[model samples]
Target: MDAVKQHQQEEYQQFIKDKIPKPNLLRNAVAAFVVGGLICDVGQFISNFGQSYFNLNKDDTSAFTAIVLVFLGALLTGLGIYDQIGRFAGAGSVVPITGFANSIVSPAMEFKREGYVLGVGAKMFIIAGPVLVYGFSSSVALGILYLLFSI
Candidate 1:
């Protein structure tokens, strides 16, 4: 019985290995570029639509579009649809601010189940905190330098 079980396990492993596709570096690089470009293209499309429909200037249109995408991404993340889309689109789904919102909320939601203090609360900002910190710090530093240089 033990020998049969071991043989079956080995065969199953072999079958899985054989069925899996081998990685191709060129294919992966091309796929990543295409998906990333597509994501940016979609964002541009949204921005353009907002600009035309609402008569918003470039900055306002961009802000509005970003807000809309972020809201939609968060909603999709809540509905559990974003994960499937992420899997399908790979870098395409991950290249936007929407993806950032999803990344921040998804892990937080999972950690919430582990308890608030140590789990959800602690881990909630694990992904996004660094981004926020860097963004804020860089902006502040740039502003200070600009002020000093302008004087």
Candidate 2:
């Protein structure tokens, strides 16, 4: 009886697997590349505008560009457009600061109804906290390594 049940389960699993659609790897890769490239292009444009029009230095211009991108990402997320873009672009949407903005805003939006302090504030960092932790840790480690090597 147990053997018969196991055989039935295996057949059901195989049936489900066969029913699932296969992904188009090449197309997905191309879409990700194009979306990612477009995001970089927008950042470049913002940086250029900051430099040419506002006369910002390179460092300041980059900061300005990052701010703009983050703002745009948050705005689009609020408007419900960023998720659509993410669905289409996949990892392309996730590889930029815009994605970081989305990650921060998305959970906050989701948990807002639970209350501000306990919900939005608490959940806002669910995705970004670990990233910040590791990012800072890695940078500090690399800085120390650089100092040691320099010495």
Candidate 3:
């Protein structure tokens, strides 16, 4: 009985290994690099637009650039385009402000059919809530520490 069970387990393990798909690391890395660079390039363009056309100050230019990127990210996510990019580019599409926008919008879009109040509003923060909470909490903590140490 013990031998039979061992043989079955070995066979199952072999089957799992054979069925698992192997990733092309070089290809994935190249794709991520290209996609991530392109995203950053778009951000730079927006910043330049703000600076050159609107004559925005450095701080305002940065704020305008961030807003535009976030809007584009939300729009792409709403249109179901960001997901496709994410599938192809993996971490490339997910390490920027745009990705943060997608994180917030994606869940809201998913829950839209359920009801705006319960679904969209509540579930909207499913992924981003923890990130926001931790981010804000840490910032506050850091600010307090800085104040205490500086005094």
Candidate 4:
């Protein structure tokens, strides 16, 4: 009986392997690279504009660029275009601040029906909350390590 069950499982696994198409690694990598590059190019353009037009210093220009990217990400997510882009670009759409914006806005929109305090506000951080928590925690830990080492 156990042998028969094992044989059946093996057959099912083989069937699944045959039915599922293999992903094209090179093509997917190229797509991700192109999308990520385009996003970075936009950030650079914004930074350049801030420096040239607004006379912002390097640090300020960088901050401005990030703000612009975050805003664009949230806007695209709100308009539902970011999800499509994310589907196509995969990690390319996700490794930037725009992805973070989408993370926050997507849940907020989903829970908006629940009301401001209970729905949108409470659930807004569901996806990104853990990420934020770990990010801050790690940064603080690293800072403390640095302080201790430097002393």
The lDDT per prediction is: 0.83, 0.95, 0.95, 0.93
- The digit string of per-residue lDDT tens for model 4 on 31-126 reads 889998999999989999999999999889989999999999999999999999998888888888899999999999999999999999999999
In candidate 3, clashing pairs total: 0
What 10-residue stretch in candidate 3 is worst by lDDT?
18-27
Per-residue accuracy of model 2 over 1-151 as CA lDDT, tens digit each = 6999999999999989978888988988998999999999999999999999999998899899999999999999999999999999998998899999999999999999999999999999998899999999999999999999999
What TM-score, over all chains together, does every model reach? 0.69, 0.86, 0.82, 0.87
Query: Model 3, which residues run further than 4 Å from truth?
Result: 1-19
Tens digit of lDDT per residue, candidate 3, span 4-123?
999999999998996888898989999999999999999999999999999999999999999999999999998999999999998899988899999999999899999999999999
Per-model RMSD to reference: 8.0, 2.9, 3.4, 2.4
Those runs of model 2 whose alpha carbons end farther than 4 Å from true positions after fitting are: 1-20
Roughly what TM-score does model 4 have, to 2 decimal places? 0.87
- Return the candidate ranking by TM-score, descending: 4, 2, 3, 1
Candidate rank order under lDDT = 2, 3, 4, 1
Evaluation by lDDT, superior candidate among 2 and 3? 2
Tens-digit lDDT string for candidate 1 (54-138): 8999789879888887887889899999898787667667767888989888988889878989998889889888888999999
Identify the candidate with maximal lDDT: 2
Output the TM-score of candidate 1: 0.69
